[model samples]
Target: MTTTGATKKVLVLFSGGQDSTTCLALALDRYDEVETIGFDYKQRHAVELGQREILRQALTRDFPAWRGRLGFDHLVRIEALAEMSQSAMTHDIEITLNEQGLPNTFVPGRNLLFLTFAAALAYRRGLTYIVAGMCETDYSGYPDCRDDAIKAMQIALNLGMEARFVMETPLMRLDKAATWRLAETLGGQKLVELIVEATHTCYLGDRRVRHDWGYGCGACPACELRAKGWREFKASPSA
Candidate 1:
C-alpha cells in the first residue's frame, strides 16, 4: 500500500514522553490523519500513562485546528504476566535504575504484546501503519526495543493477520541526540522542549521538578537516557 497521496492514517503507540511524543509529531506531518493509543499495561508507574493522556489533551488544545485531525483513541490497559513475576513491571518487584543488561523493569514481551494488540486494533480499523518509540541507539538496552525485533514482529503480524501493516520507527536509527534533532526539525526546538517539559519519562513517576528539556526523577533508565540525551543536545545545540 502506497502512502503517497493525502491523509494516510497512522497509529502511534504513544507514551507521552520525548521519544513517543516526537514520533507523534512526525506522524502528524506525514499522515493525513493521526490517531494514538496509549496502553497502561499494568505498569508499576501508571503515572506515565496519565502523562500520556495529559499530552494528548494538551496537544489537541494547543493545535485546536487538529482537535478533530488527531485521535487519543483510547487508553487501554492489559493484565500483567501471571506466572513469573520476577519483573517489577508485572509484580511487586523493585524496578531498578542504571544496572546493566535488561533490568528487572524490562517487561517481558511487552513491546511484542503491545504491538500485537495495537496491530489487531489497527487491522480492525483498517489502518495501514503503526508506530513505536523503541530505539536501540543510546538506549537503556531493552532487547525487545530493537529494530530487528520490530521487523520480526512485523513479519509475524502480517503472516498472522494476512494484512500489510508498516511499523514505522522514526527513532530507530537515531540516538537521543538525533531524536532531538528530528523533533527540532519537525516541530521546532521550542516545541520539542515543550514536548519534553510537558511529558513525563521518569520510571518513578516523579514530576516534581521540570528540567530545561523535560521532567525527570533524576533516576531510572528513562531518566538517565533523557539526561544523557539532553547532555548530547547541549553539546550539539544545532543538532
Candidate 2:
C-alpha cells in the first residue's frame, strides 16, 4: 500500500469527519509521506474545517515519529460551489426527502469535485495517489458515493490529466460499524476516541450536543446513522 515513487507521498481528501479521519490514519500507516486537503465549500458544517486542523495537530503531537512523514494540511476555499448548489449540507434548508427519494443533504457533485481537486493537488505535488473516504455501504443514497461512480471518475480523471493517477477509496464497501473497527485497527482506541470527540458530522452543524457516537445535532440524518453504527458496533462481541 506504499507509494510507488521516490517521494512515497499520497494526497488525502480529508474532511475531519469519522470516515476521512480514519482514512487519514490509514494513509499515515501506509505511506511514508501523507498530505491532507480539506474543502471550505461553505457547508453548513463549516466547523469541520476547524476539526480538520485539530486532528492534524493531534496526529503530529501523538505520533511524533511521524512528524516529518505527515505533510501539509490544505484547506481550499471554494464558496462559489456552495452558491451554485442547494443542499441541506451547504444551504439552510429543510432536511427532507427529495423528489428522487434522496435526502436533501446530498450535495450534487461534491465528492466528484473534491476528488478532482485532490488529484490536481497531488499532480502538482508529484503524488499519484488520491485517497478518499467515500463508501457505498453507508452512502445514505448519495449517487456520487457509489463504487461505480468512483471507478468512472478515476478513469475520467486519469484520462483528463493524462497521468496514471490512483483514486483510492478505502471505505468504499465498509459500513459505519466496520469503519469504527477500522479506526481501531489503524491507530487503536485512542484514535477512536479522537474521532468520536473531535470530528464533525451533523448536517445541522450543531456540535454542542454530544453522544456516545459523537457530537452532533442528534436528529440529523448523519447523526442517526452514526449513532446507529456506534450502537451496533458496541453491542457486537468483537467491540
Candidate 3:
C-alpha cells in the first residue's frame, strides 16, 4: 500500500477527455511508471479513442522522461456492454432527461465495470494503483461520478480481487474550471493548451467546430459544461 522510495506503477482509466488527460498528466508527475487503458464500448463519441492515441504520442514527445516508463497504452473493446446498455451515449437515440432527472447519457454500471476490469489488469501487471477522472462537480448527473460510489467501488474491487489496489480519482471534487487549473499546475501552460486543443468532450461527437474552450458541438451537456468552465476559469485571477 505504501509506495515510498520505490517505483510506483499506475494504470490510468483514460478517456481522452479534458479531465482524464489532466489525470494522466498528474499520474506522469507522481508515479514512476504509468500506463493508460481506454474502453471502446461503442459510444457515440468513439473519436475519443483516436484522441487518446494522439495525446499519448504528444505526451511521450513532450515528456520524454516517461518514454520508457509509460507502459503500453491498452484500448479494450467492450462492445458487448454497449449492446446491453440502452443509454444515449451508446445507442443512436436522442439524449434526454430520464425520469430520475439524470441525463440519458448516463451509462449504468460503467465506472463499476471499468474499475473492476482495470483492477484485474493492474493486478496481472503488478500495478497497485488505478487512476480515473470521474468528477462530481460540473458533471452530467451521473451517479457513478460521485465520490461515495467510487469509494465503495474501490473497496469492492479490492475485496473481490484480494488485492490492495488503490483507485485514484484526482478530479473527484474538482469542477471543470478547477480541473483546468490543476492541469496547468501539473504540466504548465503547454499541457493546458494541449487539453483545450486536442481533448474531446462533446457527446454529440462534433469536432469540426472549435471554441475558446475546446472542440465540441456546443449544444450537448458536455460542451456546455466545458464552455462554462473555460469562461469561469478565464475570468478568475488564475487565468
- Total clashing pairs for each candidate: 2, 0, 0
Candidate 1 deviant stretches above 4 angstroms: 1-3, 64-68, 82-84, 90-100, 237-239
lDDT of 1: 0.78
List model 1 lDDT by residue over 59-104, tens digit each: 6676544456686476667765434445665466566643555687
Task: Kindly state the number of residue pairs that clash in model 2.
Answer: 0
lDDT of 2 at 225: 85
- Predicted candidate 3 versus true structure: per-residue lDDT over 1-239, tens digit per residue: 24588789999999999999999988887788999999999999999888998898888798765566677888888898888888989988998999999999999989888988898889889998899999887799899889999999888888988988888898887898898899888777888899989999999788999898889999989999999989988889978
Candidate 2 weakest lDDT stretch, 10 residues = 1-10
> How big is the positional error of residue 43 in model 2, measured in Å on the Cα after superposition?
0.3
Candidate 1, residue 47: how far the Cα is off, in Å: 0.9
Off by over 4 Å in 3: 1-3, 64-66
Clashing pairs in 1: 7-32, 8-32
Please give the TM-score that candidate 1 achieves against the real structure. 0.89
The C-alpha lDDT values of all candidates are: 0.78, 0.87, 0.88
Q: CA lDDT of 90 in candidate 3? A: 90
